[model samples]
Target: MCAASAFVGYSYYENQLLADTTTHLLEHYNSNYVIQNLQGTVVNTWVSWNLIQGQTLHVSIVNDANLPEDKITAIKDAILSNGTITVDDSLLHEGPQGTSSTRYKGWEGALANLQSLPTKFYIPQSFAISEGSNGAGDVVITLTNDENPDGLSGYTKSISDGNQILKSKITIYQSSQLSAMQLGAITRHEFGHALGLAHSTDPSDLMHATIRTDYPYISGCDIDAIKGLYSGDERSQVMCQ
Candidate 1:
């Protein structure tokens, strides 16, 4: 009788432990973004440049409209704030090939000294202004005066194969109306997209579909989301803490 009682007690303890472990795992899995496959199995889905390329993302800046020097500088500064920027005028511009307009030339001369920038935040990634052919894994930023019917200030389109992002194109529209500060905010937001971040539900967050924040810089929540993304958390939309 005692042997049977001991056996029952041990079985109860083992079952309870397993139950607790399963609950913990479920909680963790549900917290991240997941999708159901055709086979009826849940799977994680996330896209990131780091998954294919290394920590450094090469960038090519093409000023098609010849936005003022300060505006161009603002764009570079915004990128530098997140990571280091190496200016190389020699990099062949990417995207929209065969334009003979000399006005579409890439920015010449070095970017303004980083120390002059008012603020600098650090992330794991870096950017290089490089010359390369189209679809060569470069983030091409183009400044243009084209007006969008949707009235968007900027737009980012990323090309990906599977979970890896091959390249990205960021176009800034209506450059004449935006001030330097406004241009910087828009650049930061689009750059986030280039890094594989989706829109955030928070209006105050930089990743919002429409930027309305007075202090439109990258926040801690944005950093946390990036860390989660690179770590394989597939969240449909970022939620602020």
Candidate 2:
């Protein structure tokens, strides 16, 4: 039942799943990101952008929480650093009610959890989690409620807060049994929220309106957006406000 919310910590455990890991000096790149192979099988990823200052991210996962807590911080770091995160684990199974306890069915409870987290960053206003048929599937979480159903607790970070407020909670399917596809998509999408991102219209992007496992990591636009948010802020400036 325990869900581990991983950020940078996951990179230390499981094998790096990101197909693109090319990161180098962005000043010399012609594209938003440059992908290079370190070896025959390994790739190095990098993005060219800066984020607003004073963004402190927090990661937390409890039982049935959809993420493993031990990897929460690593997860946050990866999201902030644009998918440079990983974790190490034997892949242990948590009980129905392990250390992870963050759970909810609908909007009220889930939103409350996000608002209550201890951090300066905050989530943006978003549509509540509801049930409906989206053209992509029975439920697609499009920008509008009737358009699509995200199927998981939706999230968006606040630029005003440097996208650090992750007090938002997550919601799992009530069926008590979910497929790996659903879990991966949901985790990726919600974590996107934690990183201050929104759904991209492009299907190739993980933030696509439809909840699918097309890309399990952040994209170039996502990296530029995050860095833009974090780049301008000076450490001392945040303290005054």
Candidate 3:
């Protein structure tokens, strides 16, 4: 890790996959994202070798009342469409962060910035709760506090149990560095990797390498790629996945 001003680092473990599937952590912007995929096949231990493992993906979503529930779910569904996504209830409402929460400041900053953008980052709460719970690890969030030091904004990553449960020990950020558009889009994209999908060079898809303009939209091709892996008999493989 660099100094507090520029914190970033990258380490890799050998072959490690849950049920032999890949997990990508969005390559993370400024290297603050966590790629949770590496775990011991034995269930409790994390894959001490590779960068991806652990089938259990625990992520806490973040946002303010300004963001609609439906929009968040849409993003959640997009991620669930590939694999499991979970959000800890502890971080969902105001219960976890409490009043003097550090997440409050960044949440306000992030929300204010998102509101300024003309994008409709809204999703149905029902969809968010249901789709996320539809077997994929998904979580609807509000208090933002995962300790990802990438300036937050719009970063996504595939987290392993160790990084989440051991290293950061945080499933979500306490500071509000992620934008509404980012919160939804990055989770969907990163989760895609969790399901074994890799980064695509296509900027028109959510699985694109970077968050290019309009890249948040899950393109038909990207969707097809995901479906192909689980349902269509095609193997899923992409860079970093």
Candidate 4:
């Protein structure tokens, strides 16, 4: 009887050790990421962009709820055409960093293969809006019929896995508060977040957290932000991550 009791005690001890190890591992994994803001001092947040292999990023939309198909198409188009913006001539000048602060205006190379956004049939409804990547190197957008609190237009949640952006989810709420054109513009703004662009201090930019109805299209600041992100320069002011 004593020997059987001893074996049971040993088994229990082993299980405890395993549980401790697992807990430690989880703590380490969760501690791997951090979030920061760009030049803006506003309450808005941004994530570092993850540049995938071949410098190509794929976009997918979650349409499981059978939301309006036309709206989905509108969002997809907005993403592909996001890099287009007219720069302000007054802001064009070479910065002290050897690269012009406005150099991102000419960054069409990043979107050379820009294509229409596609629809995906499945995506998890529940997810942790965390700091690192969600294990997918692409952007996923979801449309909801629910109302957004605080009279906000839309929001983007990005995940990073260490230094790279693992995944980003953009949520757009459907409401009568916004016309179809305004909704499309909001999608473009969220897509900027998925691309690792932060909220711009300038309200005229689409990357601004609260998009202006008058400046619906992407702006020079938005273009510069993306260009700086993929510019391969370590000192660019528009930083990711």
**lDDT tens readout by residue for model 1, 153-172:** 77876666666666678878
lDDT per residue as tens, model 3, 158-209: 3346323221111234223344545556655554444445566544345665
Tell me, by lDDT, which candidate is best: 1
- TM for every model, in the order presented, reads 0.61, 0.35, 0.37, 0.54
Candidate 2 residues 1-241, lDDT tens each? 1235564467644444331221111011110111122222222221111213322323333333333433333322322332232211111122233333122222222333344333333332123223223222111222222211433233332222222331333333321222333334455555544433445555434556554322344444444343333343222110100
lDDT of 4 by residue, 60-144 (tens): 6655345565655555556543244444433433123333222121112224423232212111111112122333336666656
Look at candidate 4 and tell me the lDDT of residue 85: 45
TM-score of 1: 0.61
lDDT, ranked from best to worst? 1, 4, 3, 2
Q: List the residue pairs that clash in candidate 1.
A: 91-130, 91-131, 92-131
Model 4, residue 108: C-alpha shift (Å): 8.4
Q: Model 2 reaches what TM-score against the true structure?
A: 0.35
On TM-score, the leading prediction is 1
Error of 2 at 120 (Å): 14
Please identify which of the two predictions, 3 or 4, would achieve the higher TM-score against the true structure: 4
